[model samples]
Target: MDDLASFLRNRRARVVPAEVGIATDTRRRVEGLRREEVAHLSGVSVDYYVRLEQGRATQPSEQVLDALARVLGLDATEREHLDRLARRPRRRTKPPAGKVRPELQRMLDLVAGAPAMIMNHRTDVLAGNNLAALLFGRPLPELNTARHLFLEEDERGLYADWDTCTLDVVGHLRLSAGKYPDDPRLASLIGELAMGSDRFRRLWARADVCARTHGPKRYRHPLVGRLDLHQETFAVPGESGLELVVLSAAPGTPAEDGLRLLAGFAAG
Candidate 1:
């Protein structure tokens, strides 16, 4: 099935009818709102909704999208994804070259006592500082973070909560797929993960969407034991699809001391 159609169907299967004030009964065969029910609630005709799910209606009006989004109870990120999926896709463009600018590399090196790295939409680690290399226990070049989490046995053990981390990463990739529908590399990466990992396949089918901007992440490092750090992501100016991620711990915390130790190790 097409991405747009599959996305709508997946989301439709998740909304609870009672949560939206529609009474539920055992007679209901589907798990979530039925297609006709969605049409009625969203102020659209059943034929149009069905056409949408079949991927026949490509250009939905803003009013229609807004109504569907409300009925589906889509979050801000999901709403944006819905809009993207509804619009006509442009011609396929070449994926980003995944090159880290010399200035950006210098910036990564200058970030003190923290692990910093640059990544693209596909989680390709374009570049990383010495501390980052120590933190991940692997060289950053040619490392796809998503692949590491799902496919590598040793790397999977680093996350204190691996399942949640993998889910969030999958959601981020889903959002990227919506934006860059024709990116062959991104498509290949998704296919590879799906074929290699059952967990990835399950999460990918959920149609979840997310953006990893800032959050606290816990890691179980061989050297540090447990390190809790907050991640900050910045989009590189003038560079499309590139983000700078820096992981730092709060002041005076044990995590901070662990970072200091890691920094020393990097220095050594």
Candidate 2:
């Protein structure tokens, strides 16, 4: 199925009918709301909704999209993704990677106490501070976070909750795929991961989408034992796809002490 159709089917299959006030029965064979049920609840014709699922109806009006989003229980990020899938041209060439601005690199360097890096939509680590280099075991430019998490066996041991962390990574990549539908680099990366890792393929097939803006992450550091940090992400001003991510620990915590110790290692 096409992306839009696939996304709709996945979302439709996930919404439990009873949760949405529809009475459930044991006789029902479908996982969630049927196509007709969605159409009726969303106030659209079954034919139109079926056409949407069949990829024949690509452009739905704002009212229709909002109704559908409501019915699907899409969060803000997923709602935006649905809109993008409905509106943007299906194919576009992503430009070649650009160098990180000197000022942005400087900003990373100035954040000496924590690990900070810049990445694009495809999770290509564009630049990172020295501390970040030490934290990730390589400079950001040398890493694609998704590739590292999914392909590298040793990388799994670094995250305290590997499954949860990797799930977010896959979801983030799905969101990116919605934005840049035909980005060859993204397609290649996804294809490679799917071929190389069964876990990645399973997660990708779920059609989940998410944005990891700010969240707590726990790391199992070989040197420090355990480090729990909060990550903050900011969009780079005037830059289309670049994001700055910094990881910091709360004051007076063991994680903070560990980071300070790591900073010392970075310095020497």
State TM-scores per candidate: 0.95, 0.95
lDDT of 2 by residue, 101-202 (tens): 899999899996899999988889999999888877876788998888888844458888788888899999998888777778888889899999999989
Residue range 1-268, candidate 1, lDDT tens digits: 1277888899999999999888978887888999999999999999999999998887889999999999999999999888888883644435566788899999889989989999999999999999999988988995888998999843348888787789889999998898788888889999999999999899998989999799988899899878999999998888878899999999999999999998888878
Could you report the Cα RMSD, in angstroms, for every candidate shown? 1.7, 1.8
> Candidate 2, 26: how far from true, in Å?
1.6
| lDDT value, residue 170 of candidate 2 | 92
lDDT of 2: 0.87
